[model samples]
Target: MISSANILFEFICFVMALCFLKGNDKFTLFTKLYLGLVCITETSGFLWMMCTNKSNIWIFNIYILFEALYISFGLYHFIKPFKKNVKPLYIATYLIFIAVYLYGSFTRGFFKFQTTAIMVASVLIVFLCLYYYHNLMKSDKIISIRNNLGFWWVAAVLFFYFGSTVYNLFMNVIFSNKPFAYEILVYIMLTLNAILYGIWSYSFICSSRHQKLLTSSY
Candidate 1:
């Protein structure tokens, strides 16, 4: 039987492919790219884990690296169309995260150090998201698109990502020695991730539909 992680990884990849194929607009295109990269990296990690009999620490390490890169790219695309000045800061931050992950992976045990880094990173990301939203609101740039879908989508992503991050940290720190418990929680987290991705995909569709309607009315 295929592992749960493998199954979910395949499903995510399939969904990402469909999103890419159907995406015609720039917004959808960026979303497709972001999700596609995430799915690819995750699937690769899972495959590596299975092939190596779940003993290869490097797979998870590389997975975290890809994840950090994905977030960096997603944030870049998210702010690029509206606020170009933030691009350099985002790039710098991305490089810092890559360096940190590489250092931790090579010097420390992959899962343990990766978990610690992710927990810290998640908190920082949440703060950044809040800052972005606050600035947009203050500038009176919180128009219909920003109000209706953009803010909510960002919130959803942050919520789910952080939620999963917290669970991962807990599994690593609290249940590290309990293999069965750790495995169960990991599966649960994977399911949550799938649900989060589904919600994100739905939000993308809604945003696309809204734009199409506005275009038609013009």
Candidate 2:
């Protein structure tokens, strides 16, 4: 269900998607489309849970599929230019993530959380983001971090996934044992969503300014 914290996160993402319409970077637009899908899924889940008063696990089960795909693709898009040799590895990791997702969905069924898939995807994406950072630090050319959209975007992913590692680990345990853990989960989610969407929104704005600067230069 939609919480007060996540609504702001979704709004920022939506506003940033509209901002992307002004820029020429198709890759940025691609991420924006993914963001749109995320918002749609989240809203639908909220409405489903609220209206029916039933679990919306299935909705999120389906969402995790697209989440892995889009984030992997986005990572590939960001890292491809910098690390050619890692191209095959990125594709392989994405395929592996899909395999894991399918396995979890079919075996565990959609009525429950895709815990295994989420955990695996989280660890894999963190590694990918770490690899990107390593390459960025090693690059011969000097660049200001302020101008690096990819850095901010990847950092957002890293922060969210890495921070959620513990939450993912204890997700089932908390729900089963701690009756009042919803508040804790809400704040954790709030922090994660804020960090993820906040950095992404800033990155889009940077991309916009970059487009303008390049056009002015030309």
Top candidate by lDDT: 2
lDDT value, residue 115 of candidate 2: 87
As a whole number from 0 to 100, the lDDT of residue 191 in candidate 2 is 87
**What TM-score would candidate 2 get against the native?**
0.92
Residues 55-161, model 1: lDDT tens digits: 54565566666566566555555665467687786777666676666677777756554765666556656655665676666664546654244555666667766
Residues 1-218, model 2: lDDT tens digits: 43655866877777886865365566666777777887888788888988999999899888888788888888888888788877687778778888888887789786889888888889899999998888888888676677667888898899999999878987888888985986787678788888899888887777677667778999
Give me the runs in candidate 2 sitting further than 4 Å from their true place.
Answer: 20-26
| Candidate 1 Cα errors over 4 Å, as ranges | 1-30, 80-84, 109-113, 145-149
Cα displacement (Å) at residue 138, model 1: 2.0
